[model samples]
Target: MIWQIELIILVLVVLFGFGALATKDLLSAAILFGAYSFLLCLLWAIMGAVDVAFTEASVGAGVSTVLIVSAVLRTTRRTDH
Candidate 1:
């Protein structure tokens, strides 16, 4: 069912968000954030917003993830007190 698919996507997004927050590695966190965005795109598509889903998949998951990963790569991966 559509609702079931939406629920699954929502769960995946939540899990990815938690993973991003809990991850120690910046690159891994960025990847998790990208996964979250991808799940959001799926949710949008299931809701019948194809245009919005396309934009979210491309911009949110693809471009934003690349930018975040590049930024992470430019900085130190570890934090110091």
Candidate 2:
């Protein structure tokens, strides 16, 4: 049962990662990346690493995602290259 839960989280993380990479919109990609981080943090928590999970949840899901989205909003979505 525990392994199954881990597998599900792993699959969700992979899907979110792919979605982030495939998305054309910077904001959408940032949101997907945040989702990926949330899933990873959940997996870590389930695996008994509470401190690491807390850090990942706070920094990755909360701070990093918000910062990335804010940066995207401040800049152009299109790349010159």
| Per-residue accuracy of model 2 over 23-62 as CA lDDT, tens digit each | 8888889999999999999988988899999999999999
The alpha-carbon deviation from the true structure for residue 15 of candidate 2, after best TM-score superposition, in angstroms, is: 0.9
Q: Give the TM-score (vs. native) of candidate 1.
A: 0.88
Instruction: Give the range where candidate 2 is weakest over 10 consecutive residues by summed lDDT.
Output: 72-81
lDDT for predicted candidate 1 compared with the true structure: 0.89
Instruction: List where candidate 2 sits over 4 angstroms from the true fold.
Output: 78-81
Q: Per-residue lDDT for 43 in model 2? A: 87
Question: What's the true lDDT of residue 11 in model 2?
Answer: 95
Residue-level lDDT tens digits of model 1 in 1-81: 467777878888899999998888888899999999998898888878999999999999999999998899899885545
